[model samples]
Target: MKSLFLFFFLAVSAAIYAQSASTAIKPKPSYCNEPPEAYDSRKNASAVKPAALPKFNSKPVMEYRVQVAILRKTDPTKYPFHRSLVARYQPCEEVWIVESKQSFRNRQDAEKLRAELAKMGYGGAYITTLVGYE
Candidate 1:
């Protein structure tokens, strides 16, 4: 009976040791499953062709004149008041206006208007040129 008990105890201890060993030595998955095409190097290397350049047509480029407002208003409330004053100078009330002209056209017209407005000594009145549209 003593030998039998000893044999049963050894068997149970061996089984418990195996269970703990298996838990400690867990299997991990492999990280190399992705194919080469999934990488940037392979994708870029496969497309070695250069992109096509765009073509342009020759035509008389239409230009536009723009009147820019260059004055900075220190007081926000004065914006409406300044606008009203500018409207007095421009009968059309176009505190802003655009005119279409040729690309090589002289900017004298726009500059003269800006100079005249500057002479009036408005705090927020100035002009600039811009590309015109049809």
Candidate 2:
């Protein structure tokens, strides 16, 4: 019975020693390849800087609204139709957009209005889509 207790104690001591010695925590490496960069983080220190992207001064685009219009012909200054709108500026200064009361949310409705205006003797009538800025 004494030898049996001694054997069990030795087996438990070996197991406890094996577990503590095998499971050692380690610190992660600073880089993967090449030398580290001073400006970059540890995870991306060895990464290469990409090329610069093209700078564009473009305005943000929103949902487009379809507009139907006809140029004023009677005095060129006065609206041909009482309900039609007039452009505020010339092309040299700013974009001249004359949106009439016949603006539509969809293309199909705008095309229908253009055809109706054409049949009504407004031969110069046309459809143009306008963004938020216009």
TM-score of every candidate: 0.28, 0.35
Residue-level error in angstroms, candidate 2, position 17: 99
Compose the digit string of candidate 2's lDDT tens values, residues 71-120: 32212344454344444433232234455554565777776666766676
Task: Single out the weakest 10-residue window by summed lDDT for candidate 2.
Answer: 66-75
**Candidate 1, 25-128: lDDT as tens digits:** 22333333444444344435655655455655654433324233423212223345323233112222213222222222466754554465566554243444
**All-Cα superposition RMSD per candidate:** 28.2, 28.8
Clashing residue pairs for model 2: none
Q: How many backbone clashes can be found in candidate 1?
A: 5
What do the candidate models score in CA lDDT, each in turn?
0.44, 0.54
**Best-fitting candidate, measured by lDDT?**
2
Worst 10 residues of 1 by lDDT: 85-94
- Angstrom error of the Cα, residue 10, model 2: value is 99
- Those runs of model 2 whose alpha carbons end farther than 4 Å from true positions after fitting are 1-75, 82-87, 91-97
What's the count of clashing pairs in each model shown?
A: 5, 0
